[model samples]
Target chain A: MSVREEQSQPAPVEGGSSEEFETERASATPKGGEGCDGCDHRATKPRRKSRLPALNPPLETTQHWFIEAITHPGTIESGMRKAQKIVGRGRVVTDGPILDAVDRMRIYHYAYRARLVECLADDYPTIQYAMGADRFERLASDVIDALPSRKANLNGYGRVVIDYLQRGPGEDGGRVPNRRFYADLARLEWALVEAVHAAPVPALDLPALQAIPIEQWGDVRFTPSASLRILRFDYPVNRFLQHFREDKVPSIPRAKTTATAVYRQGFAVWRMDLDLNMVDLLDALLRGETLGAALAPLEDRLDASHVMAWFMAWVRSGFFATVR
Target chain B: MSARLGFPDLGIGIGLRTPHYRHILDERPKIGWFEILSENYMQTEGRPMMILDQIAERYPIVMHGVSMSIGSTDPLDTEYLRELVRLRDRVGARWVSDHLCWTGVHTHNSHDLLPMPLTEEALAHVADRVRAVQDLLGAPFILENPSTYVEFAGSTMPEWEFLSRLCENTGCGLLLDVNNVYVSSRNHGFHPHVYLDALPMDRVVQFHVAGHTDNGDHCVDTHIGPVIKPVWQLLRYAWKKGANASILLEWDAEIPSFDEVRADALRARRYLS
Candidate 1:
C-alpha cells in the first residue's frame, strides 16, 4: 500500500512501543545504581589507585542528575543553537520535567532517521532529486515534527511515513499526493530498498549438477535466499528508481498493475520479472519444502520429466546455496 | 582478506561520513585511516556503500556498527554478521568493531546503544559472543567502549577493569572511543583523563574521537560537531600512554565542507606526527 493507503490503516504494531521499555527511574545513578533494583551495583567502592575513579555524588544525586540529562534540554547552553543547525530542527526540548521536548525529539530523531529515510526514500527522492539540494528535506523536517522515531535502528525511522504521506493538503496535517503514479511508485521503490538490506542467507550450493542425488534432496528443507523479495505495484516503479540514478527527465508514470522480483546478486540487488509459477515456487520454498515436494502441490498436469527439467535450470542459476 | 593485515602502527583516523566524503577524496588527507559505520555500507547498492568503497581504496577502513547490539540476549543476529562480513570483504576493512551494549531484549531493536551492566557474567556472555562474531567474519574483532548514560546496579568492577579483562579473555582488540570517555565521565562525574590512563594500554589497538554535548549536569556523546578541548587533550594523553594506532575524527552531524573535514583529519594527523 502507498503511504496514504497505509495511513487509513491503524497504527502499526511492529517495533512500536514495547511493554517493558526501560523506566530507569526519574534520575541517573552514579558509579552504578547502588541499592537500585533491576540494576547491577554489587560493589560501590572503587579499585585501589586506579587512574579513573568511580563516579561520585554519593549515587543518590548522581542518579537524579543523569535522569535530568536524559530528560531535559538546557536553554541555549553548550553550543545548543549551533548544535541545532548541525543536528537538524524540530527536535523537542520543551516537554515535561521528566523528559524535555528537545531531548526527546533528538533521541527519537537520531534513533529512527534511517528508517524514516527507508520509508520515504522513494516518495521523497523525486523531491530529493528535483530540489537537488534540500527540497525533500522540508518533508523530512515535517515528517520529523509529526513522527519522532521510537525505535533504535536509524533504518527503522519511517514506520510512520505511510501516514505522513496521507495527511490532507491543508496546513499542519495537510499534504498533497502530487501526481497520479508517484505515490505507489515511491512505495514500490522503497520495497526494493527494503529487500536490499533484508536478511541474506547462504546461497544453496548445487554441487556437480545435482550430483548429490535427487533422493537425498528430500530430507532437506530449502532456506529462503536472503535476497528474496516480492514487489507488486500499479506504476513503473523500477523506471522511477532508474531515473533517479541516471538523472533522466522527470515524467509521470502510467497507471498499470505490476508485480516484480528483486534479489541480491553478487553484492548487488537487481530487479526482475517473475512468472506466477516461479513466484509460487518461491512461496513454497519459503515454506520450507524440497523442490519436488513444492512443485507437487501445483495442479498443472505437466509431465514429471518436464517439471524436473525446469526446476534444475532454476537451481543451476545458483540462487539457492545448500538445499539443507 | 589479505593476511589479516595484522595491526597498523599509524596514527589516528576518524569516522568517515558524507559531509567529509568530498574532502577526503579531494585532498587524500594524511589520516592514519578511516572507519566507516558498517551498517551504512551493508546495503548492496547505494551512494553510501559506493562512497565507502571509493574511500576504502585510498585508506584502511574499519567497519564500525551501532546495530550489532552484542549485549542483547538476542541469538547473535546471524544475518547482521553475514552483512558485516560482506561489507568487510568489499572494503577490505582492517577490523570490524561495535560497542559493548545491548540495544534491547527479545526481537525489538531500539537503535540506541543502551548500556549493559558491568558484571562477570555479562562479561563472559559478551566474550563468548565476540568469539562467535570473530568466527563468522573470519578475522579478529574489536569491541569498543560504549559511552553510557547510566550504570546498572550490582555491577562488580570498575568500567576500565571490566574492559581490560574483556580483551584479556576474548583476544579482541579495543577501539576506544575517546569522546565517549569525555561525555561519559562528565555525565557520571569522573575524570576523562583518568579513564584514559586506566585502560589496559597494550590491548588498545585503535581510538575514536568525536564531539559531545553537555547539559547542566551531564553530557551526551553527540558526534555532531568538532572535538571539544577536553576531548582533544584526552586524545593526546591516550597517544602518550599507548603505542601509536590509527585514530579517526568522527564528524557525522555537523559535517563541514570537504576542506573543513580534511582540516579536522589533518589536525589529528598533526598530533600523530
Candidate 2:
C-alpha cells in the first residue's frame, strides 16, 4: 500500500448475515470507547441525522460531498456537516450491517489524517521526536487541513510545513514551540527528502577539475548538481538535527545565521555547514558566475590558499557536475 | 488455470519497500517478483530510479498506483498518464495497476482511495475512463478492488456486479486483492465467497493477500503482520475458483525484514497446493 492506501482501517465486525438489506442494527452500532488508532477524536457521540437526500445523487455531486466529508479538518460529524453544506445532501452512504454510516465514514476521515501524518512523520522524524507524537500530529494535521494536496504524488506535500511554521504564532493554536527554529528545522529536513528524491548526477572529480585548463578557469562556469541546495537559516537546526539523530535531544539553540549545503553523492545524502566567505563564493557560483567573477566579490575575504581549500572541498563533496 | 490476457502467474511475491531495498540489492533475494508503488518512483529521477533500474533488471516488477482517481468526475490528468507511460517503458514493468475507486475530485487529491457509488452512472463513467487509460497505455490497464468502508445508499448493484460489468464493457484486467475482498466483505456484512463468486474470475490477472485488523465492527485493510488463516483461505478459494493470477503480498506498515516478509508470503504456497 502506498502512503494513501496505508491508512490502517478500524477493526472489522464479527460474523453477520450476508443479506444485503438485513439490518443488524443491534450489533452494527459502534461500540463505546472505541477510537481510531492515533486519532484523538472518536465518533462515540450520537451522530446527527443524515442530511443527504434519499434520491440518488449525481456522480459529481456525490464525489464533491464525499471529498468534503473525508477531507474535513475536524471530527467525522463536523465533516458531514461541512459536506452537507457544500453538496446539500442528507446521508448518501448506506449504513452497512457491520458499521453505521457515521462510523463507516469515520474510518476514512481518521485514515486520511493518519496516512498524511505518517508520511510527514517519515520525512520529519526529528521534528516528530522533538514535538512529541501528539504535538507533531496536531501540527501535521493543521498543515494537511490547511493545504489539501493538489498534486497526484505526495513526495512534495511536506514542502508547506516550512511556511506553516514560519507564518507566526496564534496561527496554529500555538501548537508549535519555537516557531522560527522549527521552521528552520523543517527546512533542513525537507532538504534531505528533496535531495534523496532529486536527480543524481556525477560530480566533477579531481581529475575533471585538473582537466579544466587553469588559464580557462576564469571563464569556466560551473554547473551545480541538480540535487544541490544551499540553505541559510537563522538557527543551527542542522547541528540540532545531528544531535537528535545520535539520540541526544539537545535544547533548541539561540538564533544564529547558519549557511549550509545539502547535496547527494551517489546514494548518500550529505549536509555540510558553510562559513560566510564560502557561502558567498558558492552562492555566486550557483548564480552562473564564472570562477574569477564568483571569487571577485570575496577576494578581500578569501586568500589564494583559502580559495584552493574551499574549491578542493567543494569538488570532493560532489557539488559541481561540470565546470566549463 | 490460464491467464486471461497472457499475464503470467508469477509465484508469491512481496512489495518493494524502502527498508528492504538495501537487502534486496545486497543479497539479491530469490523472490518471484516485486510490486512497486508506481507513484513512489514517478516524478523523480533520484536514488529510487537508480535502484529501480538495477532491481528491474533482476526482478519482474509490477506497477501498482494509488493516485489515478479513475472514478472521479474530473477530467483525467493527461500529464500523469503520460508519466505513467514513461515510467512503464523505463521500468519495463509487467503491468500497471491502480485502485477501482477515486482519490478526489475538482482538482484536489485527498490521497485516500475514496469509494465510488455503485450506480449505472458511475459504472459507465469508469468504463469510459478505463478505455481512455487503456488506449493511452496501449496495454490492458489492471484495477484492484480498494478496501472501502462505506457503501452508497443509492447503490443499484453490488461491487462485484459493477466490476464484472466494467470488465465486460472494457477490455481491462483485474488485480483481485483477496485481503481487500475479505476486509470489505467483513465491513459490509457480505460473505467473502459470495463476493468472489460474482467476479469474472477469468479476468483476474493477480491476487493480493495480506493481514488486516479486525476492529470488532469492521475490518481495516492495514496490511500489517502476516497473512491470517482466513485471508490465505480466501486466496486459496480464489485460486481454486480458477483465477490463475500472480500472487503479491503487501506489508506496508511495520514491515519486517525481507526474509520475514518472504516467509510470510511463502505461506501462500501451501494454500495454492
TM-score of chain A of each: 0.49, 0.82
Tens-digit lDDT string for candidate 1 (B10-95) = 55566666556666767787766777776666544543565566788888787788778777666787777887788788788877
Judging by TM-score against the true structure, name the best candidate.
2
The candidates' interface RMSDs, in order, read 14.5, 10.6
Task: Indicate the docking level reached by candidate 2.
Answer: acceptable
Q: Compose the digit string of candidate 2's lDDT tens values, residues B200-245.
A: 8999988898777777767777777788999999998998999878
Query: Model 2 misses residue A156 by how many Å?
Result: 0.8
Q: Model 1, residue A258: displacement in angstroms?
A: 12
TM-score between model 1 and native = 0.55
Q: Which ten residues in a row have the lowest lDDT in candidate 1 chain A?
A: A22-31
Assign candidate 1 its CAPRI class.
Answer: incorrect
Candidate 1 per-residue lDDT over residues A109-152, each given as its tens digit: 33333333334543345546643435465566566556654333
lDDT of each: 0.56, 0.80
